[model samples]
Every structure is written in structure tokens, then in C-alpha cells.
Target: MNNRSQISHGDKSRNTRLGRLRDLVPVTSAIVGIDLADAKQMVVVCDHDSRVLARKTFRVRAWDLGAALDWAGQKAATAGFAGVTVACEPTGHRWRILGQLAAERDMAFVCVQPLISAWARRGEDLTTDKTDEKDAVIIARLTAQLRCYVPEVVDETWGRLRHLGARRERLVVELTAQVQQMRDLLECVWPAALTAANYPFRSTTWAATMTVILDRDGGDFTRTKRLGLDRLENLVRKEVIRWGAEKPGLRITRNLFAALDDRAGVIAHRRGALERVEFLLADWLETRRRRLEVEQRMVAVLDGLELTELVTSIPGLSAIGAATILAETGDPHRFSSARALVKHAGLAPRERSSGTFVGRTKVTGQGRPGLRLAAWRGIWGTLRVNPVHAARYTHLTTRGHNRLKPTQAQAAVAAALLRQLHAVIVTGRSWDPDVATFGSRRRPVEVAA
Candidate 1:
């Protein structure tokens, strides 16, 4: 035989042996479901075939992660398969390290919805006893069917902005509560001050009014002879000059004077009423100032983003409004449809139907409350300036539903507004009243790049 033939035959014989070995190999891969907690995490590693490879508790540390990854890799290699994919349920901000570990190891990482896991466990078993081992298995099975989603990975910049936005909301709520408390405090002695102030307890002007009244030598103006009404009017004008900058509007000063008139004979003489009002007014002012600071930061952060311009193009949506909506909703395209967005925001209609008999449907209110609040606030702003929205509001209130109340009609309009917002954001197009209001024969708008 020739040397070439001999070499070729030997090579063929070697390839046959390798092919036989490959056929004998069993394909194996793992899906990890980690039930994350504050101190220790429950890690469940299961094969693609739904067999548990390892279930153990590990402290959240670098060493434990390395150990888990090594174990899963060894198991997969022993079973003659590819590498494993890691999954975890996001419990607040605890999943960040897990994601980092997966990325470093080049494993597929996913977040399973807590609701999905909890729902499955509860329905499959009647008891609510939480077990890490069982949850790990459930997560693995559900993940096999792609029952998980990629969470929003907020970078440092957006994370700071998100914190600021949350802070602003908290301050607003606190300021509102303080204002209500101030109203009650004053009501104990002077019930007419709110009427005279022509504003709520937390109104910036209301606090300013108290400041002026407090600064006067006669603290309780109800006596009336001490600081006359005209002098109080002078203080209002001074405030407009002091904080109003050089703005051309006198509406605040005018309102302040009108409120001062209401302040006449409205002073509370009780020491408790006086002290509480003073304390609450000062707190309300401070909270309002902090809220303004948060707003400024939010606007700055939103302006820095690549997408804010597209958002601001919607009429009546300032930078603050745009920031709130974007932060709460994440990416508009992530949602399958506008209806899905509504459901995520807890605005989706809930049906009370069984068989052919149908009951009244209402919004679930189970989704993100912040998103719903931001949506309604955005709608209110649109209604004020957009003639298109104004016209829609008019039609909705009058002819949309014969039996719908005014609030229900408004709610219907708000839902439409959410759908339109999704369209505007996704299409990268400014709102066009002509296209939105009039019947269109044109092609649908394309999503932006």
C-alpha cells in the first residue's frame, strides 16, 4: 500500500472512534434559580431535563458564587453538555451581584417575575409555606419556558435621577400632609384663615403669608389694631419683589393681597394653635424648597438623556413631566402593546365575568401606582394646553357614553391619552393634532430607530 493511503485510512479510523464517542455522550445543561434574600441566598441548580443537580444555601459573597459556578460547570461537563444559565428573582436591588457574576462567567442571566413564581407556587400547592428548595425548582421549570424577563439595568446616571424623582414625590406628599395639619391647627382658633388665604395649607403663598404675619410685632393679627391690613399688603408686595425676581407677573402679589384681606380677624389666639401653625408652615416651606431642588435635578438628568427631546415634543409635557413618565414606564417598546402598558400601570380593566354572564369591569389597580399617577398627571397637563386633547375631552364628556359619569368619561380619555403617549414615544414623532383627531387614510407611523 502507498504511504498516502495508509495515512488516509488511519485518519478515517480515528474519526469513526470520535463519532462513536460523540453519539454516546448525553447532552446536559443547567438552569439556576436563586431565591435571593438579604443575608444568605437559596441556590437551586437543575438540568435542562428538570433534574435537580444541587440545592444549597450560600452566603452572598464572591467565594460562594465561584463555588456555585464551578459546581454547575462540573455537573454539565460530567453529563457531556454545554454551560449553564443563571436566573434569579429580583428582590429589590439584591440581584445586581448575581447579574455581575453571570456576566463575568459568560452565562445567560435572567430575572423571573416574583408574581409569576408566587402565583405558580400558590396555585400548584394550597399552602403558602415559603421553601427555598421548592421555589428553586419552580423557577427552573418556569424559566425553561422563558417565563422570565430582562429587568431594566439602570446605570449610575439614571439611578441618581430615579432617586431624585422618588425623593421629590416623598417630599410632595409630606408637604401636603404638613399643609393639612397646618389647616387643622389654624382651624382650632381661626377657621376663616384658609378662606381668606384662598389657598391650601401648603401653598407657597400660604407659608409666605404666615411668615409675614409672624414677623409683624403683633403676632396674632386677629386683634387687628396691631398690624393693619394695608401694612400686611405691603409685606406681600415685598415678598413678590424678594423671591419673584424680576418677573413681569403681579398675579402672586395680587393674590397675596387678596389673601391678606381674608386673613382679617382670622387669627387664632390659642398658644397651641399658634405654635403648631408656625411649625407646620416652616416645614411645609422647607419641603417645598427641597421638592424644587429635586425637580431641578430631575430636569437636568432628563435633559442629558438621548430620548428626552422626543418626549418633550409632546405638547404640555415639560421636562419634569417627561422625566416622571419615562422613569416609571422604562422603555415604551418593551411593552407588547399600549394595552399591555395599561396593564403594567394597573390601569387595565378588570372583568368580573363567568360563563355568559358578565359583570361591570374596573381598573385592576394592582400594577405600579406611580405609573398611574404620572399618567393621570400627564393627561391633566395635556388637557390644559393641547386643543386636540381639549376637544377630545369635550367629546368624551358629552357623547362618548350615554351612561358614563363625568369622572368615568375623563378616565376613558386618560386611557386614550396613555395609548397616544405610547405611540408618540415609540414612533419618535411629535404629536400632530391633525393626524390624531381627524380620520386618517395614511399608513401607520413607523417606530423610531
Candidate 2:
């Protein structure tokens, strides 16, 4: 007749799936599931056998956090349990506050993946309807069955690297968008501008020429023709000199004139278009500057870590890339093995097959995306410079019977890179090219010089 008693299942076979996790949640322990929210949290207490004991909602405050823990602990004690495991789905960053509160009391705080909790909800209720109360109980049940893991606690240094890495990723995405917009504008107004020399946006010459075009008669390609080749060359040289860069040569100036001569004739909204271009250029430059500043900070933080030297010892991994990856993977030594680290990075390959049908295998991609991205970016440089990685990539793609696609081979290499990174960091040894590859004993294949 009680709300807590109505939620029990009579299945005894589920115990077989617990396997080794039975030790983590003993019969004397209680599981406290917390559904974290921005303003309030839903807490549910359950015994080791998954019978709910008490459920309550607490406001989002430090005092309320302590009260929730105390209430769960009192319920746990009344239910004849000696220990408590605080569990949550880690919805956003709100769970950290509760987890921290639980940690201060020596309570075991664990996380159930959101995907796992969702599946458990569907399996439990036969309906998709959800509420914080239901989710809280589901989390407790999952914890009772030991379907959760304790998250790594990082120090202040790793915390700084993690946040900075996230900031840098956002800035890069914004800078990329702005650059694309600028390209579109150039295509509309000055089609020949891009064909001049493929000058990068960061180059001094490109910025100088763009400034000249924007200042001369409101960015009109036609007006630039009246300035003539000599005068235009002088203006660009002066602008370049003002930026402390070497002056553009006569040949470069001539190419600019030729490019402008082929520009599209006076189009409507030319003035508005130039104004938009000027705004975009200014905005893009500012974003680029901020991104560089973040990168510098990332490098500075990376310099203080002991793992930096070990990770960057690998030919292709840059200091910044190593910092990003390490930020996501707190201390690599905590991982049990290289395979464990690879799985943590979500680079572990997952195969799908049932009965007679077999499907293509791909990575699970269930791990930290930032860590995966850092490894992927590092692999690009590794393939270019590290002969061992290049050889492995080639073998994976060019193998006789099981040739992997380019992208698949890249994933494979990325996984291997993660494993190798864990290896060097844990073992405290430098990367050895001769022993790096999987099958190094075979005859050496000649790589182009």
C-alpha cells in the first residue's frame, strides 16, 4: 500500500548480470539517487535490493544539499543499511554540487550515463513518460544493480586546462564561421581577390590589401582602378609598412591590378556590401586575436604539467593538442590499461552483428568528444611526420584482405595514438619509433623521403 513498496520487480535472474559489481553494492548498503535540476533536486533512497525507502525534493542550495544527504543517510540507517552510495545521471553541471557535498561526508558518489538511464526508464515503465520523481528512482535502481561508475576527481591544474580547452574550441568554431562569411562576401564583391595569391587571412599582406580596398572610395573595385597601378602599389606598401611588415613587391602589385580589372561591374547594394565586409573583417580579426590568446594560455598551463613532455615526445602531437587531451583524461595512470584509455576516449570499435547478419563496425563514440577530437587532430600531424604512424595507417588502408576505409583507418590510428599516449605517460618512457608499431618485427617498408 506504500509508494516505495509498489516499485519492486520479482525477477531473480537479474542478479546474474551483476557479476563482480555485487561487491560494490552490498546488502548492507543504501543507494541514494538524485535527479539534479537548476532550482531543485529530486532525491530517492533505495535499499540494496532496489526497494525504495524514501523520496524527497530539496531546493538548490548548500544547506539544502546537506539536508538532502542527511535525510538520505537517516533513511538509509532506518532501513538497516550501513553505507550509502549517491548516484545521479550527471545532467549538466548541477550534479557537481551534490557530488561535492556527498564527497565531504565520505559517501560514494557515482554517475549513471544519461543514455543508460533513458534505456532503463523505458525498460522499467513500458512507457516514455518521464518526471523527476521517476528518474530519481530509476537512478537509485541502477545504482543498486551497480550500473554506475565513480567519476575522476581532478586537481586545480587539470581543471584549468579543461575549462581553457573548452573555451578555445568555442573560439575556433566562431572564427571558422566568421572566415566563411568573409569568403562569401569576397566572392560577391571582389571575385578576383581570392585568386591573387591565395594569401591567408592571418598574413600581413592580405590584411593590408583588404584595408586599402575598404578605405579607397568605400571598397569600390572601380574606384581602385583610378588610383592606377603605381599609386595603388604605393598605398599598399605604406599600409604594409605601417603594420611593420615588408612591402609588397612590384609583381604582387601588378597581380592585384590585374585581379581588380576583372572584377564584377557595379552591382546593387555595393555600399551596403562593403560595409558588411568591413564589419566582418574587424570582427574576424578580433576573434582570431582572442583565440590566439587562449592558445597561448593553454600552452602556458601545459608547460607546468609533467605529462606534457612525455606526451609531446611523440612526433606529431603538439603541446596544445596534448594539453587538450590530457585535460579531458585527468590522470592517465588512473586508467587500468591502454585499452581502458582508448575506450574512455570513445575510440573503441563496436561491432554490430546478430545471428546470420553482420554489419560494418564503427567506434562507439560514447566517450568524451573533446578528448576524441584532440586525439584525431593530433593524428593528422602524426601521420605527416611520424613514420611509424604513417606506416600503420598505410597498412590499415592497404592490407590485403581487410582493407579499412580512409576514415576508418584514421579512427584506428587515433585509437592507437590514445593507447600509445597512455603507455608513455603511465610507463614514464619516451616514445621509441622502432617499437611503436604493432608489427614492428616485419621487414621495413621504404617511406618516401
Candidate 3:
């Protein structure tokens, strides 16, 4: 059976080459893209070659999503796909629920950058004619062409804490607005009160005292024999007596008392609301602090390798910064070289060359924003503590670089810090600022010890 043996050898060779090509392209066996809409979603499934295998539009509700996933899974099975990956543009709260559901099913899910997708689609036509179905197809094609990392499923605790943080921010904003409104109202009736107190509506003690002052009647203020009048006078005297009889201060006090007596209902309502908000905020702050501590502890335990300790040796880098870099980059070995790490950190300048013209180089913000922000913050903090970094910053400012405008200098420092961090993590050694800067021309002047 020599002919049979030859056929078997040829088939194995062809399969090996096909596998290499697939690896180069980075496409999974099957991929689905979702175009999120208010009431529904448009979904498209594609094979490895970017050919649409199945397409459908479905409702964007919880139950509907379950049904859609089942359908997609069945279709994928029938098409002989190894595994299914889904991509969608996040629409805030609308897509979070669906995304979580998708993650729970162990299916790969990625949130495509909206701007990148738009730019990719722009090459298709001169006139923009976008629809849900077209967007779905485009998204599917994008996933096939450019393999993206799937987002990790966030823990329920983190989600709950994040929601709490958002709610707290909203409440704080509302409180500020209400306080401003109250101050404006008080100023309109009694400018003296506004001036003497310096906008005391924001102070809890002042608000409580004002609540009592405002509830009094004008008759009570004019009367000398009534208990309520005496109480009102005593409260005002206690709160504002520090101002003495200074005309500006006394005038403000008198006008405030008058306004309180006139608009008792509004003042009392706002004061009560402010006190309630303050109480809730105090409780929330305590809970948030406790939760944050727990999260930090958890992170420490999860990444207890020597890498974290090594990264902490850097002047400005902390555990959180180190962890962020590690999590974002996955593994240091993934970077074939140090320049790969630099490019991934967005610290490397982008090049554009065409014929005889080479365009001005600029830092391409193509990497993780969280990592970039952490690096910048670490560099700034290090400059404050590390003499070498501070000297570098000072030298940069003195050499015709505007001291007030030091963003580029900061970025340079961040790049240096990142490089040091990577070295420290990889080598399991503590970082020494002096040793690290020994060979660099940008090294600061050394002082005799």
C-alpha cells in the first residue's frame, strides 16, 4: 500500500502548514460580534476567514440573551467550530448585564474600542451608511482580523463596591448642589448672613443652628417676653457672638434671622435633608474604606510572589502599581525584548515614513490607560522622594524646558521607572536608583557623601 502511505504523509504535511497559518492569523474557530442597541442587539457569527456563517437580531433582555447564546452555541456546534468568542462595544449599564451573562457561560467576550472600530469601518465607504446589522458584521470581521484579549470576569464584590462608589459620588454632587441653592436663597433674603458666616450652610453645626433660627416667627423675634424669642436670641448670640457688634457681621446676623423667620419651611426642609445626607455619607465612607482594605489584602495574597516585593523597591512604585502592570502585561516573557515592553507601555514614539518624508514622532497611546496612569503617578511620587529623580526633573526644567510644563519630563521619568520595574520583577532584585541611572547621560550631578 505505498500509494496509501504517500496520501497519509501528504495530508499530515498540509495540516501542519494550515495550523501554522491559523496561528499567524490568530483567529479562533468561531467568533460572534454584537451591535448593542436600546431595545435589541444585532449579532453576526463568522468563521476563521471572516465569512459570515450565521446572522440574527435579538432582544436585549436577560432571558432573550440566554436564548440567543443557546442559539449561537448550537449554530457554532453545527458549523464544527472548536470554541466560540464574542465581541461587543460596551454601552455602560445596558451591556454590562449581558456581558456578565456571557462570561458566566465560559465563552470568550471582548469589548472592542469604539473609536478603533469606527476608524476600521470608515475605509469601507465614502458616505456613512451604518446600521445595526452592518455594525455587527463589521465587528465580527474585526475580531477575525485582529485577535483581541478577552476581558476578565470581575468578581461580584468588586461590582457591588464599584456601584456603591458611583452612588456615593452622585449623592455628594447632589448635596453640593443643594447647599449652593440654599446659600443662594439665603443671600437673596439676607446678604449680611451670607457675608458674616462665609456660606455656613455647608457646615453641619451651622445648618443645625440655622434650622432652629429659621423655624421662629417674626413675632417671636420682636417680642421680649416670649421663651421662643429668648431661645432664638440665645442660639444666634452663641453662634454669631464671635463677630461682636461689627456692623458687617451684625447686619448679616440680623438679615439671616429675618430670612429664617420668613422662609422657615424651605430652610427647615433643606437643613433636614443636609443632615440626612451627611449621616449616610459618613456610613458609606466607613464601608468603602473597609471594602478597599479587603480588596488590597486579597490582591496581596493573590500575587504573593517575589515579583511584588521587587517592584516595591522602586522609589515610587507600590504594590498596586506593580500588580496593575503585571496583570495588564500578563507575563514579562510575552515581551520578546525590552523595547516590546516599552511599546506596550506606550512610552515609545510612533514612526511614520513615506518616501522622502518622515513625520514628527509622538507617543502613541495605544496601550493600557490604567498602566500608563499608574506609571505617571509612580514617577511623580518618586521624584518627590528619590534625589536622583528629583535632580533629573530639575535638570530637565533648567535646560530650556519650561518648569511649569513638565509633562514630557514626567513621561520620560515614567518610562525609566517602568524599565526599572520590569528589570526588578524579572531578576528578583531590589532597585537602587543610583545604580539604575549610573550609565545614563541624564544622570544628575552627584554630591559628595
Q: Quantify all predictions' global Cα lDDT against the true fold.
A: 0.68, 0.79, 0.61
lDDT of 1 by residue, 354-400 (tens): 99999897778887888888878777787888787778778766773
> Against the true structure, what is each candidate's TM-score?
0.78, 0.86, 0.54
Hey, what RMSD does candidate 2 come out at? 7.7
Comparing 1 with 3 on TM-score, the higher-scoring candidate is 1
Clashes of 2: 0
lDDT of 1 at 348: 75
Model 3 clash pairs? 192-252, 193-252
**Quick one: best lDDT, which candidate?**
2
TM-score of 2: 0.86
Kindly list the per-residue Cα lDDT of model 2 for residues 272-300, writing each as its tens digit. 77777777777776776788788888888
| lDDT score of residue 236 within candidate 1 | 58
Model 3, C-alpha of 5: deviation from truth (Å): 35
Runs of candidate 2 with Cα error greater than 4 angstroms are: 1-24, 222-254, 353-358, 439-449
Q: Cα RMSD (Å) per model?
A: 11.9, 7.7, 11.6
